[model samples]
Target: MYINGSWTDAEKKQTMEVINPATNELIQETAKADETDAAKAVAAASTAFPGWKKTTAKERSSFLLRTAAILREQTEELAEILTAEMGKPLKEAKGEIGLGIDYLEWYAEEAKRAYGEIIPASSSSKRLMVLKEPVGVVAAVTPWNFPVAMITRKVAPALAAGCPIIVKPASATPLSAMKIVEAFDKAGLPKGVLNLLIGSASPIVGELMRSPEVRKITFTGSTEVGKKLIEQSAATVKKMSMELGGHAPFIVFEDADIDAAVEGVVNSKFRNAGQTCICTNRIYVQKSIEKTFLEKFTARVKELQIGNGLEDGTDIGPLIDEGAVKKVQEHVADAVQKGGTVMYGGEQASGCTSDKFYTPTVIADAKDSMLISTEETFGPVAPVFTFTTEKEAVERANHSDYGLAAYCFTKDIGRANRVMDGLEYGIIGINDPIPTTAQAPFGGVKESGIGREGGRQGMEEYLEDKFVSIGNIE
Candidate 1:
């Protein structure tokens, strides 16, 4: 772990092995930090916060721009490490690195635009000004999926807003986060401005939350975990931004082009082996075109080649571990028991090196009562249900406690507008399956998460507004 602008071992000198999920082989070992290390990192951030907040926005942006260039130059090396640690395919891994670069570049420019406001006062002699200031030290905890992108998503905005950050990356994927820290260090980032640590979540998070110097926490992971952090951070009342779990629904209306819908679903559902938070979990098709949609969607799913992530022409890779495979199996069995038909690829693959390779699956005649419908199926399984009308589709899609992202396909602008407004989600994709970008506000409502991650809204989470009034002056 890189802490206080230096590459160092854990205080306890303990280490953990990083395994390649594709082959279940040991890739490398990383330092395992404890509460002591967490304190060191947090103290480093706190010590740097004052000077970092004093620097001009353009000065901070220069470091971010340099880091972005370094990331692009080392894309191949970083993508390999990411794919080996997490089971995403090499192509997707490269795309993730590119997305990380986009975040750094976008936030670098967005930092310059963190504008304050001048409010009009009732009295002629009174002047009111609102100033934006950094919220101080930040604790950033990111998850395993989209390892690099999630780290950049949190760190870029925080750094751009002039807050020093201490990162606690997911233990399952720390190497990717370490690589990013290295790039930032090489870009001449000030000492102690950014810190990284790897350890158990509870202890590290507890240490950061209990410290009064840590002013904010940004996390991306499961909703249950987010809630726990919310409870833990209550003592200090830290500002928080969470991008939690999602069970996104993809609705294909009768008026939509069936082929285009199939293509969209294929791209969104199978990317990263369906491990992303915004991937399509439930498919709602109009009853009139249910059969047609299933046939096309299943046929496309069958063509996805599953193998090692580093291998060329591999469409999908293994799950992160055996536990993920078991979860996918359990969901499939429950859906099958609930009368859902297994259309294609329901079981583990035959010729894979490990049992972690679950085949790309498609389930038809699915109902909302099944476990797959209610919970997030973070695997290569698609459980599809049919709807009779637009109202029924919207009702079923909004039935879940999660509302991160939702998608719909329609040619009629009136129907599209109606469904978009009716769906309860943070992001709505109309004929576009992948609705996330560095330029847009990325977050969810309800149980999905709190606050946003990208765009101008993301910078606000790390800033505090201070009101100043001047009277009887001039």
Candidate 2:
């Protein structure tokens, strides 16, 4: 646990073990903080809030810039830790580290742009001003899939907005979060300005929920847990932002370039072994090109090299754990029973050292009734479904309760525009699958999530607008 500018343990000296999903090997045991520790961390943040928030945006920006520099200097080391703990390919792990650093650098500049506004007054001698101010202490619960990136996504913006924050990373991947704390410390961020709690989610988040001093909560994970947090936060009425579950729809229009569409799908769905929320959940290929797309897609998917993340030229890595593997198996089994045909890979890979490996799978003739269509598979399984018309493609894509991300591959400018406007998701990728960046808003609509991360809107999530009216102003 990192609290009040120092590294400490739980009050009872409890600890939790972190394991490498690639090999099921124990990495290390970290502090298993409880409600008491949560209270202390929140109290520390509350105490630091007045001083930290009073600092000018430029001063905070400097701290963030320094942290980014430190992270850049240690990118290789941090990426190694991420790969060892999270089981992402070394190349992908480095990319995540780079993206995390990008967040810090982007928000460092954006801090200076948290602009206020002056409103026109109706009466003479009256002035109206709207000021953007920090929303006080904040708490973040991050997911394990992109451990380093998720931490920076929440923490960078909060710190830039001049809010003290407590971050509780998923228990499976706490080391990456801890390294971030170390970077912030090296950069001399003020005590309590940023804190880390490694433990069970219930006790730490429950304590944060009960504390009135903690005014905001930002979470990136499943919708089910997001709902529970919403219920708990009702008592405090804390401002909440959720980046939750996503069953993103990837569409290949009849007019799209077949080669480009195949490449885009591979990058989007197979990257991270299809564990990402925005990874294509249901692939919709126009019936005209369904046969051609599948033939090329299957050939491409077979070329993917699967093994340990640490090994050279490994494109696909093991699933996070045994449970993740089981979920993938279940989804594949259910889809097959419901009439979906396996095109390429389906069962677990034989040569892999661990049983946590599941071969990248491609199943055709997927239907809405199948389990893969409704639930998030969160594995390297591509269930290809076909659509007949533009209307049908749009309808089938928007049928899911989740509206996080949707991708469309179309060469026609007018068709691309139409699909972009028609999709209900918060983020849409036209002819591009990996569309996320530090400068764009990343979030979802409806049950997928609430509020946005990244871009200018991200910094605003940590701020509150205060309206001031002055009368008798000379």
Candidate 3:
């Protein structure tokens, strides 16, 4: 699909094979875009920028809502391709598309809500106001794990804010993102308003970030990569919002419902095989409940069925690739050597050699000294440890260099509030596993990330502010 105002054959002949990790086979293929194609896409976006930016908020909002409808209508196709291309469970993939649609619809309505504030002027003839405007051309880079949703989370708002966008989706899973762009085109988005180039990140991203026409960037990926992006973006001094790596802390209080805590950790940690940036990687329970927490969590972990993502009722799917599998294994082995106990599903599977499924693992007696508890494992490994007091739990959760989302369970409202306040991470939940919502802000502190991604906060990422003053000319 040629998104940059025209449908022309790609310049390069190279291509990327979309591989299904579940079966380790090629699913589909697309031309690997060269730097020339990247330039064409940005140029198309630059040409469209003047008109898109000049569009009234109401017109932009209407087009965004139409795009949302198009996304909803094509969700099934999007989900099937996501499962085939990225290896997420079909059901979860479907849900991810739904979330993508919701983000667009949410932002469509939000466009109307955008307001200008009047600044007090010292004199009657002098007037001042602050206005929010789209940040010219946006270069959005999204990861593969949650391909469809992450793209929508960034692209939807930029369009809603009246910005022409140029997207660079992950090379591993570009099909799902491609389908989304197809949806936008079908929805009749104006020419060059939304465009994308897929292939080598070095060629695509380097050129886009350095382009004078590209005014801002919103990225979701590794912290190391994000740091590099920040440095590169400095060259143009472009606007940037980064959602990087995370080491989420899942804390269980003694007063918590043991069954609920076990279920919460298993569901959130194993979903996507722990590929999420905010997945619960560290489990810190009150010393009194640690014994009970491990017993229940481990039992549940053993019952999960690992299989192909398309299989009905499959609880777990393959890691994105061999690198993720190796990383999870290394972390587990390191923890075991450091006195960690594997009560269930710790070893890699040899029985299913053809498949890429890594068993959901439960580690007990884990400590901060181990890599599993300190690093962002980014796999289906949940390590559990004990804490003596509120102060201790807070300190333990904050010990990591990365701080994204943190979770805690307690019926005591006061203690829940305290945990919410004391935790150093960006997003926190009390008795709730998923803290992300369309109405509230989501992001991280420290190495986890630099800015928020959801709710009203995300809209602000794609926009810039300007102040206008009118003085008396008497």
Candidate 4:
């Protein structure tokens, strides 16, 4: 764990083993923190808040810029650590590092643009001003899927907004978060400005919620966990921002280029073995092109080379753990039992290095009633459903409780606009597979999430607006 500008152990001197999902080998042991350690981290952040918040935006941004540079310089090393711990292919791990660097660099410039406003006064001698200030100490809890990227997404904005943050990364992937902290520390971050704790979620989160100094809580995880945190933090009434679970839908219209749609679906679904929150879980294709799309998609899915993340030319790697594999298997089984046909790659891979390996699966003739259709399948399984009309496609896509991301492939301008507007998701991709970027607002609607994570809005989550009215002034 990192706290008070130095590397330190937990109060109880306990440790948790970090395992490589590819081989289930012990990578290293990280400090396991409890409530006592959480309190210390919170105290350190609270103590540093006053001084840190007083610094100019430019001064704070300088540190972020330095950190970004260091991250780029050490990209290979950090990517290796990420792949070893999280089981993403080396190429994808590098991409995650790139995303982390982009967030730091983007937020560094955006910090200088956190502008306040002056409102027109009704009376001659009155003045009204609105100022945006840091929301005090922040507790950021990030998930394991994109460990490094998630940390940067939350921490960069908080730090850029002049708020001190204490991070609790997923227990399964704490080492990547620690590496990021090391970079920021090496870049001359002020003492107590940033902290890290690795442990069970309940106790640490409980400590943070109970602390009066901690005014904001930003989390990236499941909706179930996000709801519990909201309930727990009710007493403190802390400002909360959550990026929760997603059951994204990928739609292919009859008018779309079938080959292009296949490529897009493959890229979106198979990347990171579909562990991403925005990965397409339920695929809805227009009946006219359903056969062609599935044929090409299944072919591409089978061609992907699955192996250890460190190995060259490996397209897919193991899931995060045995539990993730089990969940994927359950979802696939449920879909099949509901009369869905396995188009390709349904069972676990035979020649993989670990038991966590699951074959890229594609289910055809899937219905909305299937488990894969209703739940967020955070795995490499794609359940393809056929729809006769645009109305049916939209209805099936919007049937879920989650509305994080939705994609449509169409050549018709009116159709594209119609589907884009019709979907309830927060983020939409038309003709393009991956829509997330550092400069865009990334979030969801309904049970998917509460707030945005990127773009200018991201920095706002860490700030509070203060309205000042002056009378009898010059």
Candidate 5:
């Protein structure tokens, strides 16, 4: 655990063993934090906030820029540690590191651009102005998938906006978070400005929820947990940002380029072995091109090599644990039982070092009655559903409670605009599968989430507005 500018153990000196999901081997034992440690971190952040927020924007920008430089210098070492702990492919892990660097660099510039406003006065002797100030101390909870990217996305903006933060990363992937904090500390971050706690989620989060010192909480994880946080934190009325579960729908219209659509679906659905919050969950293809799309898509999925992330030429890695494997199996069985056909690779992968590996699976003629249709499988399984008309496709895609992300592939410009408008998701990709970038707002609507990350809006999540009115301006 890292708290108040130093690496320290929990007050009780407890530790938790971290296991590599791919090989099921013990990697290292990390310090385990409890409620007492959480309170100490909160106190530290609160103590640091008054001075930290007083620094000029340019001064804050310099610290963030320096940290980004350090991360860029140690990309390879950090990437390997991330893959070893998180089970993402080495190349993908490197890409995540690069993305983290992008966020830090982007927010460094945004630090200087948190613009305030000057409003017209009602009288000649009066002046009205609004100022942007840091929202005191923040507490962040990040998920296991995309460990580096998730932490950077939340922490970069917090630091750039001049807030002291305490991060509680998922126990499954604490090393990546620890490494990032180490980089910031190496770059000369001030004491108590940034802190990290690793341990059971209940005690750490419970402390965060009950502490009135923490003015903001940013979380990226499941919807169930997000709700619990909301319920617990209602007493303090802390500002909260929640990026929760997503059940994205991938729609391929008949006019879409079949080969390009196939490639896009494969990239969107299977990257990180289908565990991403925005990955395509249900693939809908027009009846006219259904057969051609499935053939090419299945071929591409078959070519994905599954093995330990450290091994060369490995594309897909193991699920996070045995329970993940069991969830995939259960979804497949339920789909097959409800009139879905198993196209290929629908069993536990053989010849792998552990039982945590599941073969890439595809199910055809999928219906909404199946478990895979409504629930997020969070595995390498693609369930294909066909539609006859554009209206039906849009209607079906907009039916889910989750409104995080949805994708549509079509070459028709007019139809593309229509479909893009019709979908209810927060982020939509038309003819392009991967649409996330540092310059655009990324979040969801409805039950998916509450606030946005990325773009100029991301920094706003950590800021508060103060309106000042001055009289006798003469």
Candidate 6:
């Protein structure tokens, strides 16, 4: 645990054992901080607030630029650590490191351009200027999936905007985040500019949300926890930015290139073993091309190699833990029990002999009433359905409370744009499957939570607007 400008251990004598989902062994531990630790972190950030916020953008960006460089130097080491801790394939983990580095670089450039604007006033002698300033201390509560990138998503912009941050990384994979702090700290980030704690959700979160010194709550986690944080933040009226749950829909049209659409759909659903918030969980294919798409997609999915992430040719790895595997198992079992068709990969992987590994699964004839269709699987199960009309496909895709991301495949440019407009998602990819990038805005709508991350919009989230009027009468 890191608090105030130093690294400390949990005085509570409690810790969470981080187990490798790939091999079912305890890899390391994270401090399960108590309310005292959380309070101490908040107090430290509060104390450092004035000085950090007063620092020039150029100075702050110097630290961020150095951090990016350090990230590149340790990319391979950090990527390996992320793979062992979070169970993502080594390739995906490496991809995450690159993305994290990209985010820091983007924000570093964005820092020098955070300019205030002049507003029009009635009188020529009077001038109204609007300025954007840091919103005090920020408490960023991030989830385990995509651990490295999540920290960079929040910390990069928050630091660039000259705001001190106290981070609460998910207990399962805090190691990646800790390594990130190591890089930033090595880059000579000032004391108190960044703090970190790993613990249960209750008091650690409770203390931060209740503290008036913590001016904002930036979270990327489940919708249930996000709402609770929203309620708690009401007391202090602290600002918030949440990137919550998502069950994305993938729609394929009749005229789409059959082979291309099938390839895109499978990759979209099974990437990261489908644990991604913006992954395509429910796929709607046009009836005219349904049979051909499934035959090819199922065959391709069956050929994927499932093994330990360190292996050279392994395509799929285990989920985060046994609980995640069980959840995916239950969802698939329930769907089968409710009359859905399991086309392929419905059980644990034979190659991965761990309790946390589940085979990539595909289901057909799944109705909206089934839990698998409506709920987020957060695993490697893909439930697919067929639609006759474009309108019907759009309607079915928008049925869920989650609207984080949606995908559609069509060669017809006009139809692609039209469907993209109608789909109720923050991120939409026409021909592309994986749409996340540090250069673009990443966030969701509805049950997926509020605000955005990445790009220029992400940098602006930490800023608060103030208007000043000046009159020259000389």
**How much is the lDDT of residue 149 in candidate 1?**
93
Better of 4 and 6 by TM-score: 4
lDDT of 2 by residue, 1-474 (tens): 999999998899999999988888999999899999999999899999999999998999999999999999999899889998989899999999999999999999999999999999998899999999999999999999999999999999999999999999999999999999999999999999898999999899889999999999999999999999999999989999999999999999999999999999999999999999999999999999999999999999999999999999999998998889999999999999999999988899997878988899999999899999989999999999999999889988994589999999998999888888899999999988999999999999989999999999999999999999999988
TM-score of each prediction: 0.99, 0.99, 0.97, 0.99, 0.99, 0.97
Candidate 1 lDDT by residue in tens digits, 1-474? 888899999999999999888888898889999889999998898889989999999999999999999999999999999999988889999999998999999999989999999998989989999999999999999999899999999999999999999999998899999999999999999989999998778778889989998999999999999999999889989999999999999999999999999999999999999999999999999999988899899999989999999999899999988889999999999999989999998999998887789999999999888999999989999988999989989999994589999999999999999998999999999999987889899999999999999989999999999999999955
Position 63, candidate 6: lDDT: 90
Residue 473's C-alpha lDDT in candidate 5?
81
**lDDT scores in order:** 0.93, 0.94, 0.84, 0.92, 0.93, 0.87
Q: Which stretches of candidate 6 lie over 4 Å from their true place?
A: 472-474
Candidate 6, position 19, lDDT: 79
The candidate that wins on lDDT is 2
Q: List the residue pairs that clash in candidate 1.
A: none
252-301: candidate 4 lDDT, tens digit per residue: 99899999999999889999999999999988998888878888989988
* Candidate 4 least-lDDT 10 residues: 392-401
For residue 374, what is the lDDT in candidate 6? 86
lDDT of 6 by residue, 198-273 (tens): 8887888999988999998999999988998899889999999999998889998989987888888778788788
Measured with C-alpha atoms, the lDDT of residue 335 in candidate 5 is 93
What is the clash count of model 4?
0
Residue ranges of candidate 1 with Cα displaced over 4 Å? none
Tens-digit lDDT track of model 5 for 91-179? 99999899898999999999999999999998999999999999989999999999999999999999999999999999999999999
lDDT of 6: 0.87
